[model samples]
Target: MTHETTRIHPAALMYAEEEKAGKLSRREFLARTTALGVTAATAYGLIGAAQPAQAGGHAQQGGTIRMQMEVRALKDPRTFDWPQIAYFAHGWLEYLIEYNNDGSFAPMLLSSWDVNDDATVYTLNVRPGVTWNDGTPFTAADVARNIEGWCDRNVEGNSMAGRFAVLIDDATGTAIEGGIEIVDDLTVRLNLPASDISLIAGMSDYPAAVTPANFDPENMLGNPVGTGPYLPEGLEVGVRATLVRNEGHDWWGYAEGKGAFLDRIEYIDYGTDPSAWVAAAAADEVDMFYETTGEFIEIIEGIGWERTEIASGASIVIRPNQLAEVDGMTPYADKRVRQAIAMAIDNNVVLELGYNDRGEVARNQHVGPMHPAWADVPRIEYNPARALELLTEAGMADFEMDIVSIDDDWRKNTTDAVAAQLRDAGFNVKRTIIPGSTFWNDWTKYPFSSTDWNHRPLDTQILGLAYRSGEAWNESGFANAEFDALLAQANAIADADARREVMAELQQIMTDEGVTIQPYWRSLYRHAKPGFVGWDMHIAYLPQMYKVGLAA
Candidate 1:
């Protein structure tokens, strides 16, 4: 038979797709598996991947996908720290762009957008007929409110402020750092103060959900409405949340098998116990859990639930209290002392004890290998001798310190290990493990704290938001003009390769002088029941609930 060289394998593409949808019998499935030269165990899938749902609009008359989450949930979208709020935000608020199922990003509320020469300006065209649950029109005003709320440091707990800082100015809530020219209800021209190529990614940044112009905190706690396909039916803090499908609206997700697959979603807050959550998953009481620690993996797998080891962007860093005198951690301010603490804590040991060696030891930089801008920087090794030398060199051989962390098992255990290592290096160490809620109440104000941060797709966005000089979320109190200049240069360059070179420089400088001691990265694990179909994992470390469905 004549064949086209570029054509795909018939058995590999169309043939398997037809049979994999559960359209073929067991015999057929086995035949196809054998023909494809694959193991049936890997190909057939546990819940039967062959039975994926066909798609249309959000008009499906469906069922519920119940989930149990860890304690300490996010009450507000704009003030979210933990990613649990992403499930609620995705229900209502819409982003200008969305990370799609195929590992690519596409426009959501924004039909499309364009950038000017220096990337200082972006013309965003909003989607038509999208409205809030209250029926108020979603316009440029709502976008302005959400972005401004993100930039306002006074607005409760907004971690995204630093990312939006350079792109906008305060003119009746929003002046386009240079100027915001509203062309129409659906279109606006954003003029930025500095050249920033990552502005669009920043637009889709977490807590970037579009909200009404009249945003209220109290209402947000109960149910701050947005333009999602589901409505918050009820929410009780750290207890339970009930969300129902909005029959009036359309879920804007694209591609095949895309739509509102669930009629409702109930988030059952299982408190802070991982074992309870794991038990619930084993008994099939809960449909999913975003994270399952290494200890419970065997139990969960034994229960026959589907498992996915996602290549997530999360790094665990030990940050020193640079501007606080509250703890005896004041010694962390000295560069040599900070370097000593960084060298003393062996990351591999922490990972082995805390994560069951699930992750790799990190380098001096925050950007992990999963990120696009990642450059292999120098790895700071575990060196007790070097740490003792540095402590003596800094004249702090007799120094004592207090390290604070979330009292949760993962963080507390890891910090305990780190504290022991530091004590061995001739430093007196005190460990104060507080509850997650209490620890985060004054999170950045903490001294000698170990923190776990989610991933941002671009390295520049993370650097700009969390490590930028004087930025709101700069946990390390890191401030360096040279680093800022290099970051700015990278943001403005627009060329991919050149920006990467600048990013490499930023990583090196932070390692040499940065305040945070990041020893390792954490692997992300998601456990789903056999009933879930079309659920995808986001490397950005947030849930994509709306794209998933309860099995029929």
Candidate 2:
């Protein structure tokens, strides 16, 4: 043993004690101790043979990391609408590509891709020598199957299916044979019905992780399986999910020596208890907590933890289902009623009261002002009198409706503000603050709720997912043949200026016809312990956990 083998990390020393207490397996302890430059005999006084040195020397590994989130259930990667499920999936599942914070494309499982001049045909080439978590070789067939899996309605990944709609004839959910063709062992081609520039944006979409087509729902939603850097070995729905680094996993785009830096990462759901999370993080019981809302900014900063502030082009909107009806007509389905709600609330008030003025008030567009394609559409002026006039004109002077949201402090306050404004506009509104789990998990059950969306590198990414007619995440139940035509038109434009122009027209068209009130955009943030390193906020607002490591 060398001189460096004599020294042990304080965390590793504690982990060794936990191993001795039977809290950790011998293999785990050995991997961790060896990562700290200690052999088994040197680490735990064992009689085993000496082990070889680890590959890298910068970050000390082997500690079991505990992180906090607001997840209710860890199952069903297809329904990963919130941060909880997606965060864990980030470790165990790999996306085809990722969007950088600067709105540039970064290759992941797919090394490179090419598009035809018309953007109708896309050819994808996967990275060489990659294998799934189960040790199966990753190939073009896997990508093709995974693409088909997304289009399968039973898989319930239709939100992602919306992005890959070129593969399916929307009118009949039938696969267009040439739409997604496996060209070779490591190559696939996408022959779309029409030109769509948004195809590149789908590479980074959630549930973009490639999987074997034969992977049933049990393996997909219950015990997770993928070609990611890590694997959630024994994932249970409501309880904590334990992710172990796949030591033999040959991930294509691993930046660090072995990709996942930590040996074990545990996701602990704190539900709606922010104080419990803060206390755990402050005491080093947890290394990270997701989405530290602006209301808790002062408290997190006071705890002296490092926090990230990414201008999340994320929008907060009151989404009306537009499906509940009255005399064969959904009230919110009326453009005038939707416009009335937009004119009722002062978005700045909600920002100040609920968000602590930490975000930019949204324009009529769903896109952030930071994006190059942003177009400042006319916002319905904040006039409660005008809102009343519009409602009265629609013969709904004192209409009654229930508004729903999460029970969290931030959402509660925001919903309260929104409800008060809507009430003032001669609408009878009852607010229902459901649990965080129910709010996002059972989103389809409710007709109206204030929704929080994450940032997308391109507006078309979110548009294709949330705004398009028949999109799986179309919670607003909004549909318009004209809007659909303009959406395709926007995505078909290859020229930047022409795309922006079309995007502007789409923005105005949606504001004048859709069932939503874009109040403001949130400033997304995440807090980490002092010992954490290499963490970055992706454009998707999902933290990049692949590069995280404990400082040496």
Candidate 3:
């Protein structure tokens, strides 16, 4: 059945009225409609009705939006539940004080904040009246508690603890002493030993979402409470998570004049394939889906559903474990050999097959043009001839390597393409595709493997996480004293120009040294039936339900 033929629920009808009245922008209209009880599919259809200019000129209210996901059991935002599969949980369950969009920090849970002299002190004013899912008031105490939990070695919150530890150490120039201090009931202050300009920017990630004092670390799957606009009403492991409106939450970042309208949101987890989720959306069985693939872009565009396409400002890279050793072998030990391997993969082909011409070729650098750090940095182009030369010069002319990747169809396709390109570049490349469940746990243990690294903060956070030794996600086992020193220097540099220069140098090192090879940047797209509204693309790539509603 065509998306247009799908019946628009009454909630969607309410949103449609607002659209016709030209009361809101396309994005605002979409956000309002989704909150009013419009299905995601129907919302997509409504968005597709007119160009962004004409379609976004309305305001709507009241709707239940249903979204789809491939795979399940990723309800917890904390811990290493599923590193690559927790976007849904992050979006629905947590609220970061600040957030980055197109590389700019915007306020979220915090009403306002300021960094002190040389980035050594940060004071944040928490928004009052915000409440957790359980109706507990959100306050500065919650923020302090969450930070302590993440940095506590005993808690082992997640892979991010190590990263936070680095920042804390840098700030205090000591072990994470008593750095977090509560200034007042709605204000918190952080004192660091050294300058850390990027610390505030990095802290604005979903993983840093505040947790209440009574929250249990072990049993967090069922009971999670945050200041977000939605609360988990039903949860079935390996199945789905149902969310209802957070009645006490009327403080969404975009809820200026109007408030959230919908009363419910249901996230259905299916298989890990885009096709499976697409089938569900097309059948009207699911409202929306996460992680759309390039192969399905064309199909979705012409399927008669309203669609919203936005740049996700993120890239997918295959991070090789630098720490893992096999049979006393360190294959990635030689930096030149790693560089050769990076040069061998043809990113252009991967972008075509995997991204469907929707994204730009990835430079080996972690930061993209969307980031302020990207300036005059040359893009890395595919050159198999040069790759062969590098491999030969490294004295590994006949090198044969096996690349490990998850068994998901998209990842399989990407790995196969890389293997073929490496073969053409005069290296023997074998692809090992394993099940998604097993791959997450075992791939990091493998000395040489290719795993996806998804959405992250800015260049500072990305570099700190991957390049800093002992970092939780530093599976690459990459360690350079010079890089570490430079990162430390950049963290303290308060001058924007100086910081940018330091960041540029870091990006150059990643590209020249080939710590990790980036193939392409990914864009986020959604498909829905017409008459739904109110879904805006954020840097984290998860749709915020409270900002959406249906037309009347």
Task: Return the top candidate by TM-score.
Answer: 2
Off by over 4 Å in 1: 1-61, 71-76, 101-103, 153-156, 169-178, 221-223, 248-257, 327-329
Tens-digit lDDT track of model 3 for 481-506: 88888887776764434568988888
lDDT of 2 by residue, 1-114 (tens): 111224444545665566677665554454333322233446555423354333233556666667776544544555566666677777767777665454445456776666
Count the clashes in each prediction.
4, 0, 50
Tell me how far the alpha carbon of residue 512 in candidate 1 is from the true structure, in angstroms, after superposition. 1.5
Per-model TM-score on C-alpha atoms: 0.83, 0.84, 0.80
Q: Distance (Å) between predicted and true CA of 204, model 2?
A: 0.6
lDDT of 1 at 313: 59
The candidate 3 region of ten consecutive residues with least summed lDDT is 50-59
For TM-score, candidate 1 versus 3, the one ahead is 1
Model 2 pairs whose backbones collide: none
User: Per-residue lDDT for 206 in model 2?
Assistant: 68
Per lDDT, the best of the predicted structures is 2
